[model samples]
Target: MISVDGLGPTDYERADAARLTRLPQHDLLVMAGARFGDLAPWRHPEYLRAVAGLPEEQALAALFVLGRQVPEGSLPAPLLALLSHAKIVSVGSGLLSADYALVRLEGLTLLAAWRAAGREVGSYAPWVGTDTSTLCRLVAARRTARTALDLGCGTGALAMTAARNGARALAVDINPECLAATTFNAALNGLADRVAVRQADMAALDLGERFDLVISNPPFLPLRRGALGWLAGEGGPDGLDFVWAIVRQLPELLTERGEALVQFASFGDQRGPFCAAQLADELPGLGLSARMLLKPPTPPRWPAFAERDEQGNLAGDLGREYRAYVQSIGATHYHPCVLSLRPGDGGLTIGRYS
Candidate 1:
């Protein structure tokens, strides 16, 4: 749970992100974008300019809270007290300049209290990720399920969204911090009780419960142990390790004619994201039909990915260990994709976003 602030709703500070675009707080929203530039780069410059344009008092408050660099006494008394109560912005060194703040994801403003990527053992990082927006877009557009399951419920985004759309949601995550965030966000978003968080690994899932819909944005990043590794992000040398295991389990966990919507980095022996081909090979075995909703055109080999990402992901140049590992395993490239699964092997719709 996030530390409580005496001056105001710290819960709001922690989890009101998904609600930002819901209300038209344009000025504050713009400032928020500026404050949270690292996560959403496209809007960075404008937000930075907005912050720079702030009056002295307000600017000091922004600086103090955004990063811990400014002394608490530097800010106006009221703002200082409020910002002081929040815990340390314990993100990776590169991101410590900005404190945990709100970020826009599609239409939802989701919270990211710490760095979004990297996996730590004692604590789980806030997982307001790029693929999560994709998962949200696909899941939110579907007809609401009677009972929805968010298997890797990072912040309970999908489960909470599902509840709002008329489903009783069960959010499960192996990480305690993630479950805490999920349950907290559920209450913060007025989804308390409706969307509950469970602590469980997808591998050990044997709940007698079955659901009409199962959604996940599982960790598909293929990283060697050298980097900041999290057990959650490990998808083996092939990276498809978790994806294959999760889909195999889905066949039994679903209600009759039930459905699933999930997103992942799809790879093939031949390199590049072969999301459709991989699913086509497996879904038939489970007597399941699927619709590959959209495939992002730029695979890992593409120019955009060839550049070192701001997060320092292994996209531009896989580190020596990572490169060696993937090569040894004959794993070439991976791409992002969203797939909708159902009980039959018909109506397999696949398309590009455009």
Candidate 2:
């Protein structure tokens, strides 16, 4: 289903796998990263050589290169076709890398491309043993719902899992590219019909329906600006902008007995108890009752920034400013917490801060 002509492995005419065996690990990764840029041809041979001896990392890096070069929503078909024949083993987290023998097939999985470098690698999906996953499981265990909603479903990991466990689901995201990836994965797992993918901002969903359950791994990172990867990492100035909005809107979106499971990050630099507590305090005013299902301390770090400016100065100070802010927070770390909420009385009540 993927066009193999212009973008296939054969297109790297100058890259010889034999030469890749001689390049150092660092050089290979750098070259591979460069190959994703407009300078791809200039770096092709070097990338090929760097990736030669190292199949796993090479595959990872190549996929990363491809991700940067390819248009969003266009990656899945090619990747799926590539992974069709191989047996993929989980490398850890949601990462999957293939042996040289299985390279052709495994290279196509989005997980492989993501690990290659298209996306910053992290425990973004809560299903992979994150604080979010713990909360989702807890809610599912108690509620026993037949249908659920995964808000801001990045790769549809949570949505697919819910479907596998007998919950028909709707996975929503604002990024059409992400929805395409989710659709690819859903088809791969033969759950396409059960897990519907929709491209829509969570704040203004118009599904014309409500659910017995709703879950989200919303963008809670407090970034000053947005980037290409999952916005789930940028939660706005207080880092609670999206989370707070979601909490307030959830009660109305759920059935009287419906429940909501959400995950968010709280910065140590924040003024009072983290935003989770703030949400709890305000929940009552929104006619909601909520409790902390899981809260794990996540270290706070400097926000990621681009090196260039509007004037295109190579020597920008924005990166330094970001680092300085992180240091000033006295925050060597940050914490991510998961909360479960339900409809409650008219008056608000704040729970004990963690």
Best by TM-score: 1
lDDT, candidate 2, residue 335?
A: 61
Candidate 2: residue 177 Cα off by (Å): 1.3
Candidate 1 pairs with clashing backbones = 17-109, 18-109, 34-47, 66-99, 289-344
The estimated TM-scores of all candidates read 0.70, 0.58
Whole-model lDDT values for every prediction? 0.59, 0.52
Task: List ranges where model 1 is wrong by over 4 Å.
Answer: 1-45, 49-65, 68-99, 106-109, 117-124, 224-227, 269-278, 299-318, 325-333, 347-350
Indicate which candidate wins on lDDT.
1
- Residues 1-354 of candidate 2 have per-residue lDDT tens digits of 111223223322222222222324433232333345521322456545655656644544443343222222322334433443222212334344332111111111122123223244433331121333344455446436678888887656667667766888999987654565566555545566788877788877787778878888777545553642554556665467677777877866787888887776666643323555566567767788776643445556444333555654323454555555566656555665666788886333333324
lDDT of 1: 0.59
